[model samples]
Target: MSNLLSGETSPYLLQHAGQPVHWFPWGPAALERARRDDRPILLSIGYSACHWCHVMAHESFDDEATAALMNRLFVNIKVDREERPDLDQIYQTAHQLLTRQGGGWPLTVFLAPDGTPFHSGTYYPPEARHGRPAWRDLLESVAAAWQSQRGAIDQQGEAVRQALARTTPQATASEPAAVLAALGGPLQAVAGAWLAQRHDREHGGFGGAPKFPHATDLAWLLERGVAEGDGDARDIALLTLTRMAQGGLQDQLGGGFFRYSVDERWQIPHFEKMLSDNGLLLGLYAEATALTGDPLHGRAVEDGAGWLMREMQAPEGGYLSSLDADVEGREGRHYVWTSEEVRAALTPLEWDLASAHWDLIAAPNFEARHWHLGVVRPTAQLAATFDQPQAAIDEIITTVRAKLLARREQRLPPGRDDKVLTSWNALAITGMVRAAGLAGRPDWLQSARRAADFIHDHLWIEHQGRHRLLATWKDGQARFDAYLDDHAFLIEAMLALLQADFRLEDLRFAQALADELLDGFEDTAQGGFFFTRHDHERLIHRTKTGRDQALPSGNASAAWALQRLGHLVSEPRYLRAAERTLLLFAAEVAHQPGAWSRLLQAAVEQQCPPALIVLRGPQAREWRDALLQRCLPHTLVLAPPDATTGLPAPLDHPLPAAGGTTAWVCSGTQCLPPVHRLDELLAGLAPAPAPPTGR
Candidate 1:
C-alpha cells in the first residue's frame, strides 16, 4: 500500500510514496501525531533530482525491517525540499549548528513534538560504514534518549530555537545618502579582487572539488570588466565561461549544463539538469558573447537554449523544474559512453575528428569503463592536424554530434520533475529574453512570452479581491502561497520581456507583480523581503537573506526589479522600498560583498541609477534591437509600438517625431531633449570618452 505521500502533487514526495516506510507528507497531521504519541519526528528533506536521496531511500526506506523500527520510534515525515524551502532552510541551519558542518540533501533531522530540532545528519547507510552509525542503531538510540534523556533533549531544542532565530539579519537603518556613500569608491573592483583571490587559475572556477557555476558572481565580474574597463575582472569571467563550455559539466552532445561538477577539473558532473542553473547561465553566456563577440559563447547560448526548448518546456508554456540525475537506478548512465560506441556511430573521417576533439582515445574517465565528453582538443587544432579547412572541420564536428545525440536519445532518459515552478520559470523567461535579444532569435522571445502568459493566466489570480501569485502548478492545480522569489523574479522577467518586445499588458503585469511583492512579502519594519509571505504558515524561523545561493536572493532580485520599475514609471514608493532594502543589508554586504553579488548589483544601481530610454513610433522596436545588439547592462530601454496606448507616466511620451521613431533619454530625473534620427540617438546614448590621464 502507498503512504500519505501518494496524494501529494510534488514529484519528489510522490517518488517516496511506494516505500515500505510509513511516510507522512509534511502537514499539521504529522505534527499532531508526533505530539499525541510523544515521539520525535524524523524529517527527511530532499528533492527528486538528488542522487543521494535515492540511495538512502533504497538502503533504508525500502527495507521492511528498517521501516518497522522507524514507525515504532518516530513519526516519519518526508518533505520535498524544493516544495518547502522554508522548512528546509530552518532545519538545514539547525543541522549546521548541531553538526558544525555544511548540510546537503537527504537531510535527516529529529524534531521535538513542537518542531524544534535537537539532532540532525545527512544520508546514513543501513549498515554502519565509513565511520557512520547504522540507520537502525541511530533510530534506536534516539528513541531511547527521548524516553530517558528528556531533560537534555529539551534543553538542546530550546538552544537550537534560539540559534535559528538569530539567523535572520538585523536591519541596519540608514539614509539613502549614507547607503550610497557606503557603496561608493570602486566597490565592484574590491569585490572582484576578493573573488579573484579564491579563483582556481588552473581549473577555471572558484575553489576546488564540487564546483558550481556561480552565475551571479561571474555576471557581476563581467559587468565590472565591460562597464568599468577592469580587464582582470573581464578575463576571469571569460576564462571560466570558456572552460565550463568545454568541460563535462556542460553537455557537449546534447545541450544544457548539469547541476555541478563532482571534480575540480569539471571532468564529471552530478548529471541532474536544473532549470534554475541553466536559465541563469544562458543569460550569462549571452552577455559574455556580447562583450567579446566570440562564437564560443554564442554557441553555448544556442545549445543551452536549445536544450531548454527541446527537453524542459511544457506544452502549456511553463518550464519543468529538473531532470533527475539517475536513469533506471544508475547515475550518469544516459550521459556516459564507451569509446567503442562512439567509433561505431561515426564514419572514418567523423571518428578521426571526434576522437581527437573529444579526447575519446584517452583512458576511461567514468568508473574505468566509459567517457563523459569534454573538449580536450580545439576545432582549430583538429583542423591543423587533419589538414582540413576550419569550416570543413566544424561541419564534421556538427555531423558527429548530431549522430551521437540521436543514438543517445534511443537510450532510456532521466526522469523529469514536471511540476511548474513560478520562480524558476520566471528566471528562464528573463534568460530567454536576454539571449533572444543578443542572438536575434524571435522564436526565443516568443517562448519567453508564452511562459510569461502562462504565469499570468494560471498562477496569477485575484484572491480576496487582491492580486497574488501561486508558487507552483501541477496537474491543473495551483497551490501554496507564492514567495518573494516568485513575485520578484516574474517582475524582473516582465521587465526583460518588455525591453525585448514592448507590450502594454506586460508592463501592467510587471507593475502588478511589483505591488504584490510589496504587499505580501516585504518586511515593512525590517526593510527587506521574506522568503515566505507575511500570511504564510508560521515556521520556527522566517528567512530574510540577501546572499545568493543556488538561485539569486529574492530580496536582492526584489530590490533590482523594483528600482528599475520605479525609475521607468516614476513611482517613488517602489524606489524607496529598494533603497530601504539596500540600507538594511548595507553592513553585512560591506563585510562580505562577494557573498552578496546580486545585492551589490542593486547597490550599484542605487549609487549610479541606470539610464532609462523610451522609444516611440512604428520603428521603435527596430531601434531598440539595434541598441541591444551590444551588451548594455546599465541601460533600461523600452520601445512601445506606435499603436500601443494607455501607457503609464514617463512611458507615455508625445507622438513620434513626424511619424518617425523618436527617443527620449533620461538619467535619474533629468531628461535629454528628444532625438528623431537613429544616428543622433545612438550618439547621445554612447558613453563619453574617458578623460585623458595626466602624464
Candidate 2:
C-alpha cells in the first residue's frame, strides 16, 4: 500500500511510498498526530541518492516486523533532506551537539510532539553489530523511555533548542576599505599557511581518507596563485586537479565525478554522482584550463560536460539532482567489473594494452573480487612496455573502452533522482558558461541559456506583490520558498550567462533577485543574509553563517554576486551591501580562513576590484570573445548588442567615433585609454607584468 508520500514530488519521499512502514511526510498533520496520540515522532531524514539511506530502507523500512514496531511505538515521519534543508540543518546540528560527532545521511531522530528533538543517530543495523543496537530493539527502548523518562527528555530538548538559538556569528560594522585591508594581509596569510600545511604532498587532496573534491578551496587557491603571485598555492591546486582526473573518483568509462573517495589515493569512491558536485567541479576545471592550459583539465571539462548533458539534463531544460550509488541492491554494482567481463569484451592485443594501462591485471579492489578501474600507468608507459607506438596503444585502448562501455550499459543502471533544484541548476549554468567560453563551444553556452530560461519562466514569479524565486520544481508544480542559495546562485549564473551571451532579460532578472535578496533575506542590523527568508517557517534556529560545506554557503555566494553586479552598473547600494556582508563575517572568516575560502575570495575581489572591460563598435563581439579566451579572474566583460547609449556610467560613455572596435578598462569611474586591438586590451587587463606559463 502507498503511504502519504505517494503523492509527493520528491523522489526520495516517493521511494518510500510503498514501504510497509506507515510513514507520514513532515508537516503539521504529522506533528498533530503525535501530539494527539501522545507518541514521539520518529523523524527519518535522507536523500534518494544516499547509499546508506538505501541500506537502512532495505534492512528496516521494508521489514514488516520493524514497521509494526514503529507503528505502535512512534508516529513515523519521513523527510527528504534535499527538499527540506532547513529542517535537515537544524536536526543535523542538533545531532552533532547531542552526540559530539559529525552527521551524515539516513539521520534518525526521536522528537517531542512539538518537534523538538530529544535523541538522534545515523544508520542503525537490522541486527546488533559493530556496537550499535538493532533497529527493533532501539525502537522498543525508545518507547519505554518515552513513558518512563518523558520529563527528562523534554528538559534535554529545551536545552538543545536554547543552544541552537545561541548559535550566531560574531558581527561588527567596518568600512569596506578596512575589511579589504585586513583580508589582504592577516586573513589571506592565515589561509595560505593553513592550505600549505593541509596539502597532501604525495597524494593530492587535503586531510586523510574519505576525501572530498573541495572545489571552493581549489578555486580560491587558483585565484590567489594567479592574482597574488603565490606559486606554492598554484602548484598544490594543479596537483590536486591532476590527481582527481586520473583517480577512480572520476568515472573512467563515462564522465562526471563521484560524491567522494573512500581512500587517500582516490582509487575507491562512494559512487553516487551529485549534480551539485559536478557543477562546481566543472566550473573549477574550466577556470583551471583557462589559467594553466592543462590538457587534463580541459578533458575533465569536456567529459563532465558530456555526462551532464547526456545523463542529467531534463527534457524541459533544468538539470536533475543526482544518480544513486547502488544498482541491483549492491553498492557500486553498475561501475565495478570482474576479470572475466574485461577479458570477454576486448581482443587479445587490445586487452593486453588496456589491462596494463588501467590496472585490470592487478588484484581486485572491491567486494567479491571485482575491480574498480583506476589508472595504474600512463599510456606512454604502456607503449614502452609493449614496444609499440603511443598512437597504436591509444587507438587500441579507445576501441576497448567503447566495447566495455557498450557491454556495461546492458546492466541495470542506478536510479536517478530527477527533481530539479533552483540552486543546483544555477550552479550548472555557471559551469556550462565558463566551459563554453574557455573551450569556444557555443552549444555549451546554449545549454546554459536553456536552463536559465527555464528558471526565469517557471521558478521566478510574482508572489505576494513582489518578485520571488522558488527553490524546487517537479511535475509541473513548484513549491517551497526560495532560500538564500537559490537567489544568490541564480544571480551568479545570470552574470556568467551575460558574459557568455548577453541577455537583457537575464540582467533585469539578476537585479530583481538582488533587490529581493536585500529586502527578504539580509540582516539589516547585523549585515549578513540569513539562510531562510524573513517570512520562512519558524525552525529552532535561524542561521547566518559564512562557512562552505558540501556546497558553498548562501551568504558567501550573495556577497560575491552582489559585488560583481555592483561594479558592473556602478551601483553603490549593491556594493555597500556586499561590503557590510564581508565585515559582518570578517572575524569568523579570519579564524578558519581555509574552511571559509569562498568568503575570503570575495574579500580579495573587494580589495582589488576586477577590471571592467566595456566594448563598443561593429567588432565588439570579436573583441569580447578574444578577451574571454584568456583567464581574467578579476575582470567583467560587457558587450552590448547595439550602440552604448543610455547605458549606465562607463558603459553609457560613447565609443570613439572610429572604425575599429574600441575598449575601455575601468576601476569604477577611472578609465584607461581606449584600445582598438585585442592584444592591447589584454595588456590592460593583465594582473601582473609577466604571467605564469601554462602547465
Candidate 3:
C-alpha cells in the first residue's frame, strides 16, 4: 500500500505512488509506520529533473522483481530531494559520517525502524561496474546485514546518532572582520592553487571532462582583484568569462547555457540548461560586460535573457524549473548539429558567416550527424571571413540564430520539469530581477513580482503566527513547510524588489519573514543555520550545517541575504547572523571555497556594505550618472535616490543641493561632505567601514 507521500502534490511523489515497492514518502506517517511495523526503511532520494534518477527508477524501482525485494525486505520510502532537502541534508550528513565519504542524489540510505541511518550510498547500477556494487546485490547484502547484525547494527546506529548529536559549534569567529581576516589568506590560497592547476594558458576554464561552470568563485576572486587593483584576479575572471561566452557550453543557437562542459576547452556541454545556472552566470557576465564592454559578453547576456523569456516561461509568466537532458533517451541529441545541417538551415552568406564564426571542422563535439560543439571564431576573424564589418556579421548571426531557434521549435523539445518549487522559483526570481537590472527589461521584473505574489498569496499557510512551506506546483497545490532555501531565497527576492522600488510592504515582509527564519532555523550555538525549522519534526538527526554542493547551501545563501538586508536597512543583527553563519562554516569554507560563493558574497556584502553612501541634493543625479559610468560592482546604487536610502543628517561640508543633486557618503549615522564631482564620489565609496563594534 502507498503511504502519505502518495497523497502529496509533488510530481516526484505522485510518480512513485503507484510503485510496487509499497512505498512511503518521508514524513511522520512513514517514520511511524516503519517504527510500528519494525521494518527498516529503504530511503531513496532524488528529484524529477535528475536524469540518473529516471535511469534508476526504470532500472530498479520500476522492475517488479526489484520492487518485490524492496517491499518484502523493508519499508520502502521515496523522497523528492527538492521537497525535503532538510531530510536530504540530515541523511546526507549521516551517509558521510558513516562512510567517511560524501553523498548525492539517487541516494540509498537504509534506515532503522525509528529513522536512524544504518548505511548509505548513491546511484547503484543494476549491474555492478567500475568497482561499485549493483542494486540487487546491494539490497540483498544490506538485508542480510540487517538480519544478522541486528544488535550490532542498533549499537552502530546509536553511535552514529551520538556522533550527529555532537555536531555543535566547533569554532566560529566572533566578528565579521575576524571571519574575513581568517578567510582571506585561506581563500586566496585556494584560488591561487586552483588557478595554478588550470590550463590557463589555453584561456579557458579549469579542469577536464565533466566540467561545471562554477564561475562564481573564480568571478569573486576576480572581483576582489579588481576591487584591490590586483591584475591577476581581474585577468583570471575576465578571461574565463570571455572564453566561456565563446564556448559550446554557451548555447550558440538558443542563447542560454547548458549545465556543464563534457570535454576540455568547454567545447561541448552535457546539454541540459537550468534557470539558476543561466541566471547566476548572466549576472556575472553583465557585470563583466559593463566593465570591459566586450560586446560578445553583452551578447551572452542578451541571448541568455532571451532564452529565459522564450523557453523557461510558465503559463502564468513565472519561470519553469528546468529542461530535461533527454528528449528521446539521447542526451545532447536535440541541441547538436552538423556543418551540412547549418548550411541547409541558413542562406549562402549566412552559412559562410556561421561556419567562419563557429570554426566548423570535421570533428565536432558530437557523435552522430547532428551532435557536438565547435570553438568560436573571434569577431575580427569573422569580419574578415564574411567580408563585412564585425557588427554586420554579429547582426546576421543574431538574426540567423533567432530564425533557427524558431525553426527548431518544430522539433521535439526536452521535457520540462513543471513543478514550481518555492526555493528554486525564488532563485529564478532573483535571476529575473538581476536580469532586469542588466537588460532594462520590465518584463523580467514583473515576472519576479508575479512569482512573489504567487508565493505570498498561494504557498503561505498561516497557523497562529507559524508558517508552513510546500515544495511542488500544478494548478494550485504548494503545501509543506518551506525549507531553509525557500525562506532564504524568497527573502532575497523580497529584498531585491524593495531595492528596485522602495516599497514599504516589501521591506516589512522581508524583515518579518527573516525573523521567522531566524526563530525557526537559527543554530544559536553554532554559527550557521539549520535546513529544517524548529517546528519541523526531528528526523533521525538534525542537519544544521551545509555543503556548497551543486547549489549554494541554503544556510550560506540566507547568510548572504541577511548581510545584504543589513546593509540596505542599516540593521546590525542581520550582520550578526551573517557573521555567525560564516564562522559556523569557516572550517568547511576554508577547505572547499568553491561551494561557498554566497558565503563569499556574504563576506563581500560587508566589503562595500551600504553605509549611507547616498548621493543626494543638487549634485546627486550627476553623481548618480557618474557612479553608473564607473564600475562599482557590488555596491547598491539608487539612481533617483529614494527614501530607502537612509542617509544621515547634518552635512558638514558646503555642498551643492538642488534637492536631488547632493551625494551623501555617510559612514553609519555620520554623513560625509556632499561631492558634486565624479572623482570625489569615487574616493567616498572605495570600501565601506566596519559595522560599529558593539552592535
Per-model C-alpha lDDT, please? 0.87, 0.85, 0.70
lDDT for each residue of candidate 1 in 1-695, tens digit (9 for 90 to 100): 13788889999999889888889988899999989988899999999999999999998999999999888889999998877878888888899999999999999999998989978999999899998899999999989999999999999988987887887777764566876666644665678888999998888889998998899889888887877788888888988998998899999988999999999988899999999999999999998877666666777899999999999999999999999999988999999999999999999989989999989898989985899999898888887888988788888999999999999999999999999999999999999999999778999988888888999999997899887899899989898878888888889999999899888888888888888888878888878889998889988888888888888988989999999999888889999999878888877777777777888888888777898889888788888988776677679999887777788777888876567788898878788888888888777555422231210
Write out the backbone clash pairs for model 2: none
Model 1 TM-score on a 0 to 1 scale: 0.97
Ten consecutive residues with minimal summed lDDT in candidate 3? 686-695
Ranking according to TM-score, highest score first: 1, 2, 3
Give the TM-scores of the predictions, in the order they appear. 0.97, 0.96, 0.87
Error of 2 at 474 (Å): 1.2
* Candidate number of the best lDDT: 1
Candidate 1, pairs of clashing residues:
none
| Off by more than 4 A, model 1 | 173-176, 184-186, 683-695
Query: Of 1 and 3, which scores higher on TM-score?
Result: 1
Error of 1 at 53 (Å): 0.5
**What TM-score should be assigned to candidate 2?**
0.96
Least lDDT summed over 10 consecutive residues: which range in candidate 1? 686-695
User: What are the C-alpha RMSDs, in order, of all predicted structures?
Assistant: 3.2, 2.2, 5.5
Superior candidate under TM-score, 1 versus 2: 1
Off by over 4 Å in 3: 2-6, 99-102, 163-168, 172-180, 184-203, 338-340, 466-473, 587-594, 604-608, 615-630, 639-660, 676-695
Q: Write the per-residue lDDT of candidate 2 for residues 1-695, one digit (tens) a residue.
A: 22688989999999999998889998888888999999999999999999999999999999998998888899999999888888888899899989999999899999989889888899999999998999899999999999999889988988998888767765665565776689856788789889889999888999889899898889888888887789998888888988898789898888899999999999999999999999999988887887776656777899899889989999899999999999978889999999889998888887787788778878888889899987788676887888988778767876887788889889999999998999999999999988888788898888888888998898887887876899999999888888989999999999998887776777778989999999899988878898899999777688887889988878989998999998877778888899888888887766667688888878877877877888888888888887777778778898877743456665665655756678888876677888878777776666322232322
